[model samples]
Target: KKTVTFFLVVLLAVSLFTQNDMVSAEIKPKERSVGKKCLEITCTMTYTTQQCSTHCIQMGYATGDCLPKEAAKPQPPEYCCCYFEK
Candidate 1:
């Protein structure tokens, strides 16, 4: 009986220790749609993504052209980064 109790206790301890590696603690970035494309555009300006969104809307679906792969990153870079689909 004592041997069985020891084995059960050992098994429980091993399972608990093994589970810690599977747990995670990281945040994921959010992706938002710009117009009708699958690619995205990012703008930097002022603060908050909301501000950048205004700029994105101006060139909206009417010109949902995907930027060249070699195009530079958006301006204002500090914040207000918006994404559009390609």
Candidate 2:
């Protein structure tokens, strides 16, 4: 009985954490982009800030940065977040 209760509590905690990650994964363009629109490009390799900016320019965005996934845990993938005129 005690074991079952402990297991249920652990499961609940895990579920709550996963739900929070899902919520925070949503992109808020206005808050993060300032006056511009933003795009997230999946980054498979390590990228420097300059490289990310250059890549964004090549893709026709005004600017960009290599940023980690927002509110993520356990080594989230990085992304090249590019900004452009709205």
What lDDT would each prediction earn against the true structure?
A: 0.48, 0.71
Write one digit per residue (lDDT tens) for candidate 2, span 1-86.
99999999999999999999888887544554333333466665666667888988898888887666563562556676776765
Q: Count the backbone clashes (under 3 Å) in each candidate.
A: 8, 0
- What lDDT is obtained when candidate 1 is compared to the true structure? 0.48
Q: Tens digits of per-residue lDDT for model 1 on 1-86?
A: 99999999999999887776445322444575553332344433333345445554674533332233333763332332335554
lDDT of model 2 at position 60: 85
Residue pairs in clash, model 2:
none
Question: Candidate 2 at 1: error in angstroms?
Answer: 99
